[model samples]
Target chain A: MYAFNYHKPATVAEAATLAGKHADGKLLAGGMTLLPTMKQRLASPSDIIDLSKLGDLRGIEVKDGVVTIKALTRHVTVANSAEVKKAIPALAELAGMIGDPAVRNRGTIGGSVANNDPAADYPAACLALGATIHTNKRSIPADDFFVGLFETALGEGEIITSISFPVPDKANYQKFRNPASRYAIVGVFVAKKGADVSVAVTGAGDSGVFRQKDFEAALKSNFSAAALDGKSQSAAGLNSDIHADAEYRAHLIGVMAKRAVAAAK
Target chain B: MPTVSMTVNGKPVTGEVDSRTLLVQFLRETLRMTGTHVGCDTSQCGCCVVHIDGDAVKSCTTLALSCEGAKVTTIEGLANGDQLHPMQEAFRENHGLQCGFCTPGMIMTAVELVGRKGHNLDEKTIREELEGNLCRCTGYHNIVKAIAAGAQAMGAKA
Candidate 1:
């Protein structure tokens, strides 16, 4: 990693101010992704504004029918949170399935969502569950949050404070993961609330996590695995890498979506 | 340069290090505690696993500055005087290692796993939980057995 100044801000206001002061500053949430990227010389920020000291941005709270996860809450906390499990077991399961136990211990939901890794699991859940991301400056819905691969709607010096997820009647996430890195090669999150259904696909789309309108419509009519029979996603505009071809990823999206629907509570 | 102070193996130590210094570097180089090996600096391999604030985390990925005032336990701290930790003993009795390169991390991860998953661990749970810790030698069959036996031994001791 390159030489850089690190600042541990005591509050969100201070952190944001420090971020604004440094033109080439990066907010260190969990540093799960940022650190690795820096180690490889992929990213070299002039300053790192560490948010670890921000005590207010580290918790999980459930109020009414919404689950609010603080920005700095580790993945392990979310996976083991009773409130999250009771309100949305699928979200808990998704959190548990990320990277591994050690990674879960350090990785944060805010970091994962902010980085907007296409192969990440949280984006799929956020998009499918219709989550709202609360930033220090303003709140952005999950639909408008993720813009592209490794990109989000967050502006310079903007820090995510928390994310609010509505409790779905039935929701589940299924992913075909890469065995080595455990990143999702193809992940599908299915969510149903009353008559509305949302299906989000990650690790497959070239433009990052996106909603499957066709699948959502099909499942809205019949909320079951059988409803997806013969329905297929187009291979176009999908990610094709050494791990999987675009066609294979498109096919896996359907397969995983069906499995998620079947397994969803 | 930044000054980082933390409790390592119950010892309060302070060091002047660069902001980019990793926790593993602080332990292995700064403090000369080489038990926490860095098999893979990319964080995929668990050779750098250690307990930071009683939670198992990859030392390679953790910044020393970030761990300010935290309690860190490495492989060297798992035993009492001359007696080895239960997990270490179980690994020895079960022949869990071949090259001994991944032993320290394997033991640390196992100890934390037992603390979280309880004393009774099945083969599948052990295998799944050992995802971050990679053992290229011994085919991991013996390691799995060692972890299971170690959990049981820990339960008995408790």
Candidate 2:
């Protein structure tokens, strides 16, 4: 890791202001990724702004059919929160089922989404569950938030305040985890809100979390496992790796989508 | 180098560390708490696991300077002189280790699990909770068994 100045902010505004002062400052949320990268000499910033002390950026709240998580809240906290479980059980279950007890306890949702790793689990929830990304600057729609692999609409030095997930009528997540990292090889999140259906696929896409129109269309017609008998997602525009080829992952997309639908119902 | 002060285990320890210093490095090199080993360097292995304010976290992935005024506990703090923590005792009796490379982290993780959910003991639940921790020893069978025993003992005491 490279030498840099460290500052812990008591408030979000102070953190953002400090971020703007430094040329190559990085936000330290959970350090699940940032610290590792620094160790590998992957990145050497001039300043490190630690966000853990910001009391406002932690907690779970449910109000008027929306589940809001402050950026600093860990996966385990969300997974165990009564309000989160009551409002979005699928989301809570997903949180409980992240990398493991260690990762779930330390890795923050904001850090995962902000980093926008192609294989992360939270992006699927954000995209499929119709979440709104609240930043220190503005709120971005889930679709508009993720720009590409490890990419997002967030500008340099921009701090994500919180994420608000709209409670859908039903939602579920299924992932083919990497044997080692346990990150998604291909994960899907399916949601239904009244007549509207949104299906987001993570892990298998190079362009980041994606909306599968075909599965949405199938589920709209009939929301059942039997309803997706011959449904298959195309291999085109998907990620291929040593664990699985795009063609194989594309098959998993359909299979997991079917299971996710069944689980949701 | 930046000077930082924090409570480690139960003692207030202060040191002058580089701004780039990792929390794992501080614990091992500065404080001589060598029990927290650095594994994989990519945060994959839970070898460097420790407690920061009662939350289990990978110390390798945290900056030492960032822990100012915070309370941290490592594997070294788990036992008193000649008395083993319940988790340690369970692992010993159950033969929970082979290479022992992952024991510190495994114990730390099991401690958190029992803290979160009492020792009910199920294979699937233990398997899921131990996911991020990769033990090449194939010693997971005994590790799970030990965790179950540890959970039972700890819960009974609580």
**In terms of lDDT, which candidate is strongest?**
1
The TM-score of candidate 1's chain A against the true chain A comes to 0.99
Alpha-carbon deviation at A241 in model 2, angstroms: 1.5
Please tell me which predicted candidate would have the highest DockQ against the true structure.
Answer: 1
Tens digits of per-residue lDDT for model 2, A40-73: 8888988889998887889888889899999999
Model 1 agreement with the true structure over B1-158: per-residue lDDT tens digits: 78999999999999999999999999999999999998988889899999999999999998999999999999999999999889999999999999999899899999999999999999999999999998888999999999999999999998
TM-score of chain A of each: 0.99, 0.96
Looking at every candidate separately, what fraction of the true A–B Cα contacts under 8 Å does it contain? 0.80, 0.90
Instruction: Residues A14-97, candidate 1: write the lDDT tens digits.
Output: 998999999898999888899999999999999999899898999999999999999999999999999999999999999999
After superposition, candidate 2 runs with Cα above 4 Å error:
none
| Clash counts for all predictions | 0, 0
How big is the positional error of residue A139 in model 1, measured in Å on the Cα after superposition? 0.9
Against the reference, the lDDT scores of all candidates come to 0.95, 0.88
How many Å off is the CA of A211 in candidate 1? Answer: 0.5
- lDDT of model 2, residue B29: 95
State TM-scores per candidate: 0.99, 0.96
